[model samples]
Target: MEEDSTGPDAEVGAGAGRGDDQSMRGLVEALARRGELVDIDRPVDPRFELGGVLALLDRGPAVRFTDVKGSALPVVGNVLTDRERIAAALGVPKSGILDALSAAIASRQPTEEVTVAPCQELRFPAADVWREVVTPTFFEKDSGGYITAGMIVAHDPVTGHRNASYARIKPLEETTGFVGIAPNHHLSALARSAATAGRGLPVAVTLGSHPAIQLAACFYLGLGDDELEHAGHLLGEPVRVVRATTSDVLVPADAEVVIEGVLRVDRPVHEGLVSEYHGMYEDYGDGCTLEVTAVTRRADASVQVILPGLAAEHSFLGALPIAAGLRHALRGFGCRATDLAVTLSGGGRVDVVVALPPEQRKQAKRAILGCFAAVSMIKQVTVVDSDVDVWDAEHVQWARTSRMRWERDLVLVPAVPCDRNVPMQQDGTVTKVGMDATAKPGDRAAGNELAVPPRETMDRVHGWLTSDGLGGKVRPTPVVRGALHGAHEDGR
Candidate 1:
């Protein structure tokens, strides 16, 4: 991930694991406890070096930028980059994340409204926000600094229901900037409704909320559904929300920073070189602008920024949510999906793999259809037996190689709708492929049994490998025919 090697060599800080505290700071402290955190106490330019440093640390540990050159607020990254880390954030075993998310969706608890919010500890009315607030350029190819991690809290103009979703906000001035929004997003529909009514849509961009809130915001619920309610269930309590200073929008009370603004949907500006989940840049063009009205944050705020586009952190955000959704959808189809994995090379939005028990092999087709039906962006689907570790890309490929016959196991659906991020997308559609990689009835004849030592021998070997005297006392050199190799190299 250290694609750019021009950054400085800084001091390393300790762990950045997750713990009982649901707050972003708490997550950082947990990482600190586990010695999985990288703390750069030295100064690093947010515009140039910060993103590179984060990219280099991708999929490894959480990073805290103690001193961001000109900014007073410290920045943190890579908190939700992998499954193990995210499972820790929710205080659940990795296997339980899907069930936890499903429960939250079904049994949502309402949020608590409060008058006092830590985010409002210090407040400023409009203008000079780019300098005062947190906006970092993740890459040099980026057109400018962006709010890569903030959740846009807005209300649907037609239904008057609140919406929380992620979008890219590039600050061009003290009060205004371009917002990259997908046309199909609920927030975009709300903005369009507001534009048709000849009114501006008010929004409060919340940064550095709890991981539960961040994950819940990405749920593919209905337009009017309150994601905060589901977030509360994930946290095992209510999420406190406070009214925005400039609008009626309710922002997370415990947020690290909140930029209250009204989006001007009628005003569309060209967004140059914006990064996509596919780890590439595309000129999406015509990004809507937001007029910053007020900024509120903690006195000693620690801003949270996502290393967007291709990074593990970015891909995991999209992948984890999809995993939960696919699991739920499959259950309704009479197939119990054991686990799911999104191929990282597919940018977490293209390829999906679903795992099932050997007994559920008959429902493989149902599981495949459930995936493609639930998510239009998925390009490829693979169904494997539960024994296959879905998370391991190599293992998934091996399952297909060992168990599947291309002619019989392949299911191809042509002219399916695909997202623009896919390279093969043509005329708004692409061909979808599904592979069934479960053991067949007569597979044992070919190579059903793997080549390995007996179970008793393997257990004894494991004990020997872990024994204290295993390395130092074992001076045996294996003999090839009559010659003894690796002998007397250490004067044995």
Candidate 2:
């Protein structure tokens, strides 16, 4: 008998994610090796069913849907939903991602140009075929299907600085879509610059590449900054690229699919409803219309989809990178920011939790202000002592409950520049708040620190629990034990 060779798994072996870890396909194979991947053979509808499965299975293994109702292409999701997975891709531990990200940004490298690339292996010139391809309507309220994982690659026409970013693309027709570009994002700035010269901005939407690049693209940097170079720092090597067929903009040479197009300044499309990363539907109003001129892909390329909303993929993609960038900027500005976290509750955009040395607690307000200015989208900041774990929501809340004094520690700023997608923002501005949750200097000598059992005693207790079949796992409570016993007795 012959081995199976009929689906996405066949095209991309378990070794796919094990490749360079610098391309999308490489990350997929890497996930497979880690037992973090699930391949589905059942045919799925692109409208909502695909996104449904992705949302329902958030934080689980990455998924690959081999069959779509009308398209030959397959779709994959949740490749970089977890911080651990992202950390692994960047060759670092979860605790070190912020430092790794900062170093990568500081050590930018130019991409190597290749004469031939896999993305251009197959080309579709017919505009009508694009709509037939698989795309996702991630939510019920979504006006139409969208490409949530596509990375936009463009260059400043004047300075020639390359930029990569993730944007929401709503398909209006086979070859045209309305892209929601926020005012403060670098991509929006480039578009505005092009519009000033009465010209359309050429762009390449590269989908299904490495998570390192995806994370890099989410960074908020200045006009002359090149995100692709920063991606190289994460990858530890220069990324390879090829010029798009329709645009001179270079895209990932190994990307599964590339949509070569132009963002028309004169053609504005009014999208009635679209899902924002905050897991809510917002009327983006008028957006620049994108004209897809060419669709290029590998022979068996996979279309990547990021389910919008509070989904892990959407949340972490925005949260982790933004937190790292803010931490980097704060430290650069002389703030003693030791660690930081962007809360999932904040939709990975508005709320940030930071940790600093106890002695530097006085500079908490300065750190908060620097973060807000560094990342305009940040609306709330919480500062905690170095011992506090920012990644743990409970720990952060505990600090807030115990250390905060409303009148003295709460800082609020009004009418700051913010992401347009924020529902609370009126006319692209919103009120921001910061909380100093770090223990006050006076509390240090008053026994304000948390109390825990001696290390040796705790270790003995942990050993006993493990002996009782709770090895390396959170101990099951009485209720869980009762339920398990009941199920066992019933022969379930």
Best by TM-score: 2
Candidate 1 backbone clash number = 11
lDDT accuracy of residue 110 in candidate 2: 87
lDDT of 2: 0.77
Provide the lowest-lDDT 10-residue window in model 2.
1-10
Give the alpha carbon lDDT tens digit for every residue of 85-196 in model 2: 7766666655667877777766788888887998889988738446435667778888888888889999757556678998878777767888888666678778777877
- Tell me the spans in candidate 2 whose CA falls farther than 4 Å from its real position: 1-21, 126-132, 156-158, 444-446, 455-471, 474-492
Residue-wise lDDT of candidate 1 within 355-468, one digit each (tens)?
786679888878888889988888899998765667668767777898898998999999988766675788779999999987778866665533433445544654676575
Instruction: Give me the runs in candidate 1 sitting further than 4 Å from their true place.
Output: 1-22, 444-492
Model 2 pairs in collision: 16-29, 17-29, 17-30, 18-29, 18-30, 23-210, 24-209, 24-210, 279-309
